[model samples]
Target: MKTHLYKMLLAAGIILFSISSCKKFGDTNIDPTRSSNMDPSVQLTTAQLRFSGDLNVNERTSFMMTMPLVQHIAGSYSNRWGGIYFNSPNVMGVLWEDSYGSDLVNIIDAVKRTTDVAAQSNLNAVCRIMKVYSFARMTDLYGDIPYSEAGLGIKAKFDTQAEIYDSFFRELTAASVQLNTARDAVKGDIFYNGDINAWKKFANSLHLRLAMRLVKINPTKAKTEAQLAFNAGVFTSNADICKTVHEDIQNPYEEVGKGNIKGNGVSASFFNGGAVPGRFTTPFLNQLNSTNDPRMKYMVKNYVDLPGGNPLNRIDITEPLLAVTGGYFGVNPGNYIWDDFKSAIAITVPGVGAYSALNNDQKAQPANFLLRFNAPFLHLTYAEVELLLAEATFRFGATFGGTASSHYQKGIEAAMLQLSLFPGGPTIPSTEINAFLQGNALIAGRELELINTQLWITLFLNGPEAYANWRRSGFPVLTPGTNAEEPGESLTIPRRFEYPYTEEEQNRVNFEKVLPALGGVDSWNGRVWWDKL
Candidate 1:
């Protein structure tokens, strides 16, 4: 009765979160808080938690679309939108809907409530940075969006991507300065627990990321902002990684998979049924195995899970071929859908156990993985910031700070070491890491490709960001999936997702205003402003 009652309560929580998440904010993001007494700290916590755990958004946007789109993982029906480059309307527009409707509504209101209040000043600054982050993610994927008048209860016209990028730099600059230890501590901050300095570092580090996106469009401005962020002190070590720490909850897969619980979305989405998780992509495995990357063993393994949503139903299994092959394998994107998934597992090779899936630690399989419910999901990391610094230094000059090669090494090393942040996560043997590093030292001529490829590898599970980086930096060049796919859409990987098809009908007047910039039509082929050809 106790267990049953607890599950019932959790189910109720998930349902509420799902229903509330779907609430429309009308023409633009109408302020969620009409009452004056509404607490901004509560709002901050709400936005942070929802942003991280909104499986509806993460699963569709990251897990389904971007992950497979980038060849990180594939082979399930869940991955087709991106894995095979199909143009699904809801899949393309879900991020826009959730951000404007719920996540943005809360954080925008939180900033309004806390702005200039002495006790809430630090909180306000954090909200400001988060606001930039939410909007940045929006623009990175769908460029030239409704920004200036959004959430103002007016018909919102699209803002050019250049204008949006300007706001990102400006807001990040102000927020980083506004964060001060002398001010009152922040409340409801999941990333840093009210630590003003950490938030400050995160803001500056994020500034570096957004700046790097401009390498193709405007190198001068990118150089300026990148150097400014480096001087302002971005994350210098693993301790400063900006990630969301989720609550350790009962039935995390059950609760979070349903979209209400405060748990890791990546984990929940990847292991939705806890029976068949998507396989590591063949291209991804090649990157690891070819280099004898030590992270391979930690990345994927064989597991045979009985048909159930409970992780406990999974049986530990291994592949004898791992030693010779140096890793387990995955099908090409879109090669194995629902029926193939069943057949593949049923007729597994004699020596290879069951099909390959993400390692036990990443999946959170009970005794095998206490890391599940509470594993910290990566947002921005020291690894990413260091790599950006490496890229910036390589592109511009030494003014951005350390030598590109040195930062490149630091970035790679940080990525290997930081996996331990996950409960029982990999502590890559230093000997192995050092060996990989020495063997793959930065070659002079191919600096750009090598640096961004490392960035691609480090950005394993965060699909949207990976997609953005790939578009902007053009690293680890991916080929379009060869599986039979939806015909009308671009056979090549899409450069950008079109605006929600509803925008054409519902907000036709305002929507049509941005069409000229979109080459007179709302299509993925029309590139974002920063995404220069």
Candidate 2:
């Protein structure tokens, strides 16, 4: 009887407590406002990190190497060259959207909220410059892109290519001027290490680059900007070249092994035992060989066994001679060895089957370059500017009344010297480069091609400017491969990438506003305002 009475009292107490707790549960929750107070600094940092990788991947694959297809030095599965088919059209659009939505917008927010006033100011300036640089590239590639209200979450609007270019120039100019202001340095600048002077120099170099780009359309203004940038003093040597470096481990947007979630990135070719070589077209290669250009050895490789020259197991044989009959190949022109003796460390093991079968560790590590690491990411080099001057002076030799050939030679020499600073040996030998110029009469018609071709080659990794120059001058006379998918089209080199998909879906109103001015919607062939040709 005592036990039964005790159990009954315990059950009654439990029920009473449960009823009271349920009534008060809603009142016990934390304030909703407290969640909003969470620090945004860490989130912004994460955005920056993501942007770095995104930029590196997009730059290396599509922009830097696409010309190989245009020039017919490389081949894909279809073996077509001269135009990049929309194999992965989304790659272009997604990158553009991410730049504004995921990267720049977050950066702007971080700059506004940073506790260190001086750091905050510099960060804002940096973001502005970066945005200008990025957007300028976007507009240059894809005729018109969303700009003015791009990163306003769901409230973004699209801007015209013309407007985008104008904004880029204006913002770049403003950022350059801002750099001149005496503000404390940005502490976490992974690119220039908080050096405002370096940032200023970079700004000026970029300004000069952008200005020079408009030479065909606005020579006078271009000349003025170039002169101003020159007078301000920009990068004169390789040390001033901007690039980002990477460690053996934590490399810039590179891939890791199987089951690795944090692997940087891997191209389709990387997964296969070999990389897709962006080989050269026959015409481009033949021209270089005919001139005995030194850069040929640096850029071409022979992976296949030559017909009747050597068998698969030939011992102590000479390197296979490659005739670029169709497409582009090779990672770095200099990476490949002409002979078996020169195979990479990982490829030397006889039983490993060949260089093609080597694992990631066994293969060559690609040097990831960015604006921060200065060996190769040249925004505006003194040599390039000098060459442009040479071209301009030569073009109007009648008015200038000087030996155009001399300036042309000087430009050639400077470009050749610039190659010496590449990760590998110089693309071309100085002697060969000089010999070619000497052999070819530097007349008006020939001289322009000569200067522009060299310029195109020197600015290899720099795609945006190179593409612009190609469209403007049509130098190097790229001949379409006979094996191109669109064989019927006449020497069709793509002028620009199509407008990103996001603009049509999200920013439809503003996108349509710029359509009439661009000839029509869905016109990838439309040229930027500055591209006079």
Candidate 3:
């Protein structure tokens, strides 16, 4: 967890200024300094750090909630079940805090600071792009939010989801145009490192994602915006993917690990220690196994051996390890439940070995290999762009000069390439990748479903986007797990998380105004405006 040099310098400078000002000031009649100023680059850097941290936090939280709702993993206990069943308001509130309290606020301040600096136009454009990205994510998660007038000291008004999306498109468009006219390089851009062109590509790529999200609710607008984004030039390759580099800041996963490890030594990276030794869902493993997806090996760890020596050393050796017998079984969602501290091994069926979870070979290492400290916080990727293009071409007759299959193949290739970034992660050989593409070709009748399902798989570790895609596209149809706590409620998957409770108490007027549009009360099943399906 190395601190950034700039952060250290900034802190030292602040302390020095405070001491020097204290020594010099004795003038009551002459007005003491009332104005404060910050370098736009410093503001940009702070905003980028806050935004990336928020994104990581959001993704990690979503893994416990939406990932299981979509059946990517299974909950083994009552508390773990909260995420799946939408029973934990406090646990879900972090998403709201991260987006609004941190990223959105810092980004607005950055925009204000950068506005008048012509030399900092590139940084200003990046700020605008990030503001749109942050707001779009907020609207997607909570429906109407404080967007148009959010972050101002005055009482803010909530904007409709449609209005927010419209503003996102306009902001991205304006940012892209501003980027094109940039005269100076950007600094403190954690995602793109002063590359204005890459920032432009990010803006357009994000626009495409936002546009496609509107497809089900507003097909005409979706098609038009998608085309505009395409014409504006989205990611051209994996090289153009936007992600924050982690050279100095500590990874959020490392922080989670520190708070969650118990005497058993199971890393919190394995489901944040919610469900003992969290196991992948049966459906998720089955999809990979059936497709012979090479990614499965990298993403999942077989329970062949346990760290700190085998706890089952005394068990009879007649029965084979579960990995040997059944080849790494995932817990079937809702099939079994138990209290925490109950051995994960005890729940396993005979000859199936202990349930498989994420690989923990690097658990003792400084940075978890699978969840590396230095791993980039992905914002956009060429893989996603190509997949979206494949869908757009098929649905809108988009003239990107390629067939759906070509875009699909490129997407698969890029996704495979992207995984190489994980420290000590597995690499899929070219032959295996080609075989996967050959077997999983986009058939004419089921192209949309197949493409979106693959998108779901590729979007692993990117939970919010995956959840949004699942909502809008309705692909990879998953059955909601039965929850005993909410037995009277239907098992339909939640459409969106409820607004944070603080909003109701603190921002009562605005919160109340938005509640009717959110189905008179904030409930998990209430769908956002773009979620027409």
Candidate 4:
């Protein structure tokens, strides 16, 4: 009941921010009903929800572009940009457009409004941490972006990824250190409910995440930050995972799915009641199917198109993989066309008769299966932190803590266990999880590939982060099983998305300066600064 009220209040706060956002800003523009000195709490709620809960950016940047680029999903009308390497500048630009247009504006205002006010110190500290979280995602997406001058509601110049990352480390360090639990708790903190300690841990964990990103470009700095974050403490358990709480607010308008703070944007990106947006690629499913993974039931199930063609019914059909294509969960990309896919998965069982399965388990999306509306947007997880620790310990050794194998086991368990947080989400039996862990131990030579492949699995819904990690650690070696002359495959996937299309016209001089770094063309083929490896 308290959670419900908070959602109502946060929704109201978002409405307030939206009013200011939708209106013109300047001396002449004023909202008399709204306070001249509105509470920074309002802006914080607005920023958090908009950043993690926005459907527009989730759909365009994550669902459409990054997910398929990393091949977690593929072969849908919406995924042409990433799936087949079709270039769509509009899709690539949505995160920049959405963030600058709304999310950044509010968060920046929150940071500025509370900056030297002693009473709002804890609030200010939290906002600073959020600022790093928000900006880190943006900078990671586009190599050099308008950071310092961003959110001033004007055309701003750009900053290199190096400058932006340096600021992230500084901000995270200060915010985690500045958090004072003795002070008054911050209101409207939907992530932690004003738990300053949790916020501290999250800051350090996030610091660790950003540090690992520096490995390819600057291993020395990476080692230093990882050790610093470790000594300061990171997430110790699932209770410490940094995530925003959400309500299963029925989206009144999903096709245009933004502005609803209570609905989960990541899930909404996959929510097409009348149609399946995409299918899990065979290479991805092989990661589970090849191992007889216990989580298979949680992630994959068969779908049948009934005789009446009554929009794909969910069923428990699991026996035809080896019978058809020598054991693969999904049809080959070569057979992605419907007619080809139909014959590939089509089979005649005695009791079941003749029926064709949908391309992948995600055809069950209309029923809110894996992509539940209330599922929390997992920003940072203990599982992810542990996995990173495992990799760091493997590379940099004891300074990062614990044996690589021990951390690897904890990470796998945590990843499987965390699924229970989803409403009606599947739960693997303890025996199964244990058996799977026992079967797969982190052996010496394959440590990097094994750790990173797990990272890819853990990053299911958060597409952009998965895409970035895939670029950083070339794991699980995705393939079309061909020479694969396309940009995104074995070693050289498309490195970055093109800059926002309007930047050429809106911020021309500054935009022109970055193009030379992109090899004289604003193409996705260009690598970002940290993509040096």
Candidate 5:
């Protein structure tokens, strides 16, 4: 499901290959005409596509690693346990390549193309906003990164995480102002579709998110930026949420799910035949089950035991081969002793399935609700904004004209309504929503814990954000995976991903220079600058 942007990239790749092939072996003369310049509009489109694709790839990568580390899901037989236990370097490297190589570089190129052009001032502002978003994610994941000198040639050096965060605050603030002043509309903006006002909101919303990250480390700066973001206007409702809608291009999550089921991608351990490699974790399911959260049914599917036939063993069948109760079972995180397919199928109830899988519903035919190929890839949501505002009100006592309770309820309501966007998602009745909200009132003393936990639940499938918040807030105290205490590794959950091996091999000098700041070792135990108490 490639889009026009992807086709352009493909064509460019082919053209480059052809030009290289035409050059005689060891030819000394370089062809000046063999240029690869694109117009600002084309470059902007490419950047937007790359950014959206990077988000999808990041989400999939996190599902295999951080998702388990945070106990959202657990592996049954595969090396996913290695991820939960902090032993997966290859998985972490994908995120580095996608963000730096694909996302950031394209955004940088687009921003460069639009610079000094009066007509493209808004486009330039949009590019800057995207660049900040990309760089923020990179710094958040790994302490120091190639920021200031990134996307330039080989001699690029790493910028300290603090420096990167400072630039993010400045860039977002400037971009917000520029967006407000520029009257020109941006072209090729897939996220907001030329809506300068929406882009402004997104810029400020992203600013708010980055500011909150500094709450523990720099309260003064956090308060300042948070207030700035409020004045600039962040997301106020679902209409203001930032997402890239899937059109000609398929959702990356859907592709990942298909590959997993086909045994060609990350092993998810769902009953796709043979041995199950992973399943939802007990803690994750328990939280939703106990709360009677309507989203549970929308987000997960009960394990169905089938009599076997097709090799793919697709789980999205309309009619179950076998029906049973208590089929939805979650594995305990860190416990690798559980048998795979055998254990999942060992059901006592006559007509009940034994284990649950993350939702693989096919009620809407080609669109699989949560796993739909055309599902919107969300960046920021009104729900998150409301929750963050609630936290700001509770922690810093910023006057937002409402108490934390009001913001919390608004967040919950927005989250519930947000799920309805899925094609075949459950209709969360007003009754269930009200019941959950009433029963889960934010107590004055335990407001932080409740807010963070609810944020965790709302940010499902958003592993990086959830992991970052958990690191910062330390709410709903989670236990390390069973194998976390393995020899030579720290028992604590990983604070950051180690730098990719390519950096060590190709940019050894610059990489070594940053080692001292990373505790003189590129290891997962090293914390980023903002992950402070």
Candidate 6:
């Protein structure tokens, strides 16, 4: 009787515990869709953060890919499309998380919950700005994004790239007007720290950037928008520049792929001898060297030989292709690095390696920045404005006011000054800068290209904007890459990245609508709507 009683008690206890657990399992008393937890306004900042990474990758590849399309293209590789490279699948990952998965839902829900006049105004402005900014960037990158019906979950429909671009400007204008009105402080202005003035400036700067995009397709509209932005006093100087920052501490997604210790660990081939391991192309090296520009040191490391040193070629040695190709100091016959050097070093790198061998070297050069505290994301700067003025004056004459050459001179000076703001950035002597400009002054026929080219170099790390300007002015006199044998050899510069493959696969109906106009998934030669010229 005692044994049976004990067994019955044990069974009862188990059943009691199971029932209690089920009652509280999915009810933590917390809403997953709260704004503080996952608002689109906050989450979309990831896109802005990822922008810098993508810019760096694109800039690195453009030397061979896009630059070659124009002229004097130097690098040889299987990717003829200028290596429109992405460091991570994270761009899409972040997009999905922020848009459909959580952030978007929270932002819309917050807008619904807030009825207080001040709270509603603040929330609405933030949401509009973020949604517009996110959609603008997405459309800029891939084209034909879902705008009108986006973030509506399964009901979302793809919008035309052209239409989306139109909505972007309209939304920016509307948001700016809304922001201009009084309200409670913006609840979460991550980019600008809830500063209304800064947001206004950002909005206008974005306007300037978008307006410039219309250069080829709608010059009148572009000029009008630029003038309006100027009148509004957008981005008066470098302090107003915007950029994302990574904590000095490393996060899983923080460092470049091959270089991240947490990700790939260390390999001997990546740190051969004293070379920083990844050297730039000889032409790129030579150009900076010739310019005597100060930025070269900050931009590229000189491990093999310092700036004035010989161009060392590591051509000899009959080691296995993988081992030979993998060394930090040399290039192989067929342009193989990891493949040729595998015997010497066995490892796979997703991106760049650490400059120092230590895994947690606190002082390791930080990852090429996505954005940063000191370096602001440049919506537009005085330098760019000056360059535009220079070009406008030159092409349209005094009707546009300043002398082309004078405006050009100012533009160059502003660019030099802008570079000075970066850590270890170059310091051009005023005399040297003046001398360089005087020496390379643009003539009546060449002023337009000259001004645009200077603007191009100044706009480094800003790919989409620079590419748009290039489409407009056709400046800088670039030659196509050295390898003209690639299949798309006929074009001068890649128009845009082909839309992602997944877009066509998953969003078929919307994809079909735009298919007739698409240049195909592999075709970087297709131009954006603004690049009609």
lDDT of each: 0.74, 0.48, 0.64, 0.73, 0.64, 0.46
Q: Which numbered prediction scores highest in TM-score against the true structure? A: 1
The lowest-lDDT stretch of 10 consecutive residues in candidate 5 is 257-266
User: Which scores better on lDDT, 1 or 5?
Assistant: 1
Leading candidate by lDDT = 1
Q: List candidate 4 stretches off by more than 4 Å.
A: 1-35, 250-257, 305-328, 331-340, 344-369, 480-492
Root-mean-square deviation of Cα positions for candidate 4 versus the true structure, in angstroms: 4.4
Model 6 lDDT per residue over 329-360, tens place: 32211121232222222223224332222111
Pairs of residues clashing in candidate 3: 322-352, 322-353
Question: For model 2, what is the C-alpha lDDT against the true structure?
Answer: 0.48
Query: What residue runs in model 3 are displaced by over 4 Å at the alpha carbon?
Result: 1-35, 52-56, 76-83, 180-182, 247-277, 303-323, 335-368, 483-490
Per-residue error at 502 for model 3, in Å? 1.5
Candidate 1's clash total is: 1
Q: How many clashing pairs per prediction, in order?
A: 1, 27, 2, 1, 15, 34
What range of 10 consecutive residues in model 1 has the weakest lDDT sum? 359-368
CA shift of 336, model 5, Å: 5.0
How well is each residue in 258-294 modelled by candidate 4, as lDDT tens digits?
Answer: 5565677766666544444566767678788777777
lDDT of 6: 0.46
Q: Please, what are the lDDT tens digits per residue for candidate 3 over residues 1-533? A: 13453563353234323322432332111122322665556545555554444333443455456666676655444225433474566656666754454346557767877786887787888999988887776678778878767666545677889888988899899899998543887765667777888888999999999999988999889989999999998999888988765542232343321221111111223333223334566678788889888877667654333322222221222123333345655555553323121233332435555543223311111113444434556767899999988998888884865888999999988888888766555567999899999998989899888888888887875667888888999988777766454452436777887776777766778789988877698887889999985
lDDT of 1: 0.74
Model 2, 37-117: lDDT tens digits are: 422333233333333334344443343335443452333332222233333445445445444433455444444454345
Ten-residue region with minimum lDDT total, candidate 6: 260-269
* Model 6 bad stretches (over 4 Å): 1-41, 44-50, 53-117, 120-123, 249-301, 304-379, 392-406, 482-492, 519-522
Write down the worst ten-residue block by lDDT for model 4. Answer: 26-35
Q: Each model's RMSD to truth, in Å? A: 5.0, 14.3, 7.6, 4.4, 6.3, 13.2
Tell me each candidate's TM-score: 0.88, 0.68, 0.81, 0.87, 0.81, 0.64
Ranking by TM-score: 1, 4, 5, 3, 2, 6
- Candidate 2 has its poorest 10 consecutive residues by lDDT at 26-35
